[model samples]
Target: MPRLEPGQPAPAWNLPTADGGRLSLSDLAGRKVVVYVYPAAMTPGCTTQACDFRDNEAVFAQHGYAVVGVSPDPVEKLATFVEKESLTFPLVSDEGKEMLTAYGAYGEKQNYGRTVVGVIRSTFVLDEEGKVEVAKYNVRAKGHVASLAKQLGISL
Candidate 1:
């Protein structure tokens, strides 16, 4: 799959959420959406990234953006991660990697100095029309939210 680029229509995906509900990208149409794809849940870097988004959730909402975190984890694991971090955003369970592949978020990753197949830490900021406003791939799991906020001129 080709890497997603800005101005391209974001690949529509559906995944089971932590609350046993299905979350589809199309359902979020007419609203700006932040799709942060992480490698896994409960990892330190992932945790920090998720917490940052949670902390600045209000700022995102004030800008008419809905945030969703996606990972190749089961619903139960996502629930535990959410409860542990007190995250208020939707945690989409992409256990099958269908959404990940569609969005080009799953691929080779350097882990512990070894190249391995894994989910690439990435974020896609979609506009109200479902067009990709920003497609930031290969992002570091830490301090990414701050960078995104700064890029968007969000005061938070």
Candidate 2:
């Protein structure tokens, strides 16, 4: 599947969140949303990326953007990850990778100089109208949030 592009409507999603609540794209209508997809929960890279978003969550909120994370982990594991990392944002369980595939966030990618098939660390910024404002794939875990913030014109 091709990656989503700017001006394209974001794929609809209704997934279980870490907080034991369901979150769907419609629930976040009228607001900009940051949806990031990671490979797994509790892994080093995933943890760093998640923490980066968590730490800068206020900045995202101040800019009217809601942050959400998706990974092929169960809701129970996601809840544990959130608790362990002190994450404040919602982390959706995508065990089936349905949402990930729809967003083109899961596919083949080069890892460690070798071709691999798995979740491609990616992020998408959706406008109030649910159109994709930005779509980034193969993003690095560290400093990703800062780069995204800069792209969105967020000072912090």
Name the top TM-score candidate: 2
lDDT by residue for model 2 (11-67), tens: 899999888899999999999999999999999999999999998999899999999
Q: How many backbone clashes does candidate 1 have?
A: 0
The lDDT per prediction is: 0.92, 0.94
TM-score result, candidate 2:
0.97
**In the order shown, what is each candidate's alpha-carbon RMSD?**
1.0, 0.8
Worst 10 residues of 2 by lDDT: 147-156
Which ranges of candidate 1 are over 4 A from the true structure? none
Clash list (residue pairs), candidate 1: none
How high is the lDDT of residue 52 in model 2? 91
